[model samples]
Target: MRLLCLDLEVEDKGGFFAYPSDFVELDCSHKPINQISTIVGSSNGLLCLTHRYRNDSQYQYLYVLWNPSIHKAIFLPVPDFRLNSNRHYALSHGFGYDPTTDDYKLVRVVYVDGTVPPQVEMYTLRSGGWGYLTASGPANVIADWTLSVFMNGVVHWLAQTPNGEGNIRNVIVVFDIGHEEFDEMPVPKSLEGMEHLNMEVAVFHGLLALVPCNGNEWELEGEESYSIWVMREYEVVESWTKRFDIDVGVGLRRVVGFTKNGEVLVIKGGKLLSYEPSSQEIFNPHIRSRTESFYFSTYVESLVLLNVEDGE
Candidate 1:
């Protein structure tokens, strides 16, 4: 369980998927998505990276805690916060596991100055930590692609209003690692207006899902027809259910979560499809040849990543 992709070009027959015939690939060729800039969440199997650069001009921020199933990586430690400008941004990032202090946390949403009013941090890898929630972040939503969706133990995102400045309305930004609270979850009010629509925040079955992808109409061999919405009641936000309508001829390219038999794990073009909406079939969990990125996230292979200090 682990699917990641970004900006492409890391081909080389990488691996993941402990269940659909079990694949493994992780020899570490500078792999943290090769110095990623975004993948910020995934619990139980750890994976929360953020590596923005530009040093000579501020904007540093580095953090990683990967665990590609024992390829074990930990590289975290650079958060005394002091960016001031490079625009000082980052609107979402969360990694979970707080089973009442078994620790392993990482929540973020900084905005030194993207539009002001957004700073909330927490690191705590068993107390070799960093913390500053100071009463939880509230900067009128967040933009630049907010992400973070670790179910039950809490950690969810999808809120935008800051740089868009006005009434954006569509909240769901929780974070409750054993009472370190900061809640607001309720998004399926018959949802719509997906900014451009392709929404994500997944983890179905283990609850807390929402996989919107309405891209209907496209027959030119480019296949297009979508409807992936799910939220069969994680305490009901009207139970937003529509799970998989996929005419997906190709190009959803990213829905990387699901398949505990619920199957809907996608990543078109770069291969790795498994969408089986009750026989709408699209098999091939063999993870086709040297695949590339379309962005991914789905993990579960822990040893607590062996406790930090491996690749800083």
Candidate 2:
């Protein structure tokens, strides 16, 4: 697989910065100094990003380039909306590429108020327009948080159901582009946790996977303390299994992404480790970092399969 590295100068404030201003793209296949400014959020691959211009009310926008060979970045100029507000309330929420129509869709979940049902807005790459999605319950249910996973020409988000005052249960909400529908799926019971442990949903081995943070006790035991659950079968609730248990002592913080060969790529401390699931063997591909003061939390970035062949 090919790896491309881009040197980005991000704002010191927390969360992802909108595209054009906060991103830099590098072409790894060819030795060129040409770096394109990314048009989407740095967290996910599919979402396009928009930032409020300091001088003007208009929002500056950009999109991510999936092609490694094309070092040039495409800047899409679209109509502005009031949704381009603060960076914290604004998120590059959900994204996905549809093969049937050969179109890419970018969605942003805008949390207007700090409480109640959350407001969601969508932007399509094909149409170069922004619109709104009909929320199921009150706007306060989703909160001002972003939780999304893309699979099969659709993006899935985690929905929250408040029990009483501060108690809440998480559910899965899926957006299908082909049919243009939003559906809900029940979350597995084993994945429940406290509020601090932010859970993430992912697709591994063509099956749904949930990665939960250990919260208060996660770092207490160090790297060995964290565990990831993988669902072997999709749309089946009982197919869940504790696929991997990480040892924080060895520097395993969490599983970032899975390789095409079914191996898991893990991030431990500031290092990257590749683990073969079947053999349970871990390989430390020590990727040297150029940054002098590297913080574990600041290293958060998206990982994608670079060299995997199509239709594999």
TM-score against truth, every candidate: 0.31, 0.63
Flag regions of model 2 displaced more than 4 Å.
Answer: 1-66, 78-80, 83-92, 134-147, 162-166, 212-225, 250-253, 276-281, 288-312
Question: Which regions of candidate 1 fall more than 4 Å away from where they truly are?
Answer: 1-15, 18-21, 25-63, 67-72, 78-107, 110-118, 121-138, 141-157, 160-168, 171-226, 229-263, 266-273, 277-279, 282-312
* Residue lDDT tens for model 2, 154-211: 6776556554656655667676866656666656674443344355566676677766
What TM-score would you give candidate 1 relative to the actual structure? 0.31
What would the TM-score be for candidate 2 when compared with the true structure?
0.63
- Give the Å shift of residue 304 in candidate 2: 17
Best of the candidates, lDDT: 1
lDDT of each residue in 119-201, candidate 1, tens digit only: 77788887766778767575456444535677778877766455565545666777787787786766666553334444546
Lowest lDDT 10-residue stretch of candidate 2: 290-299
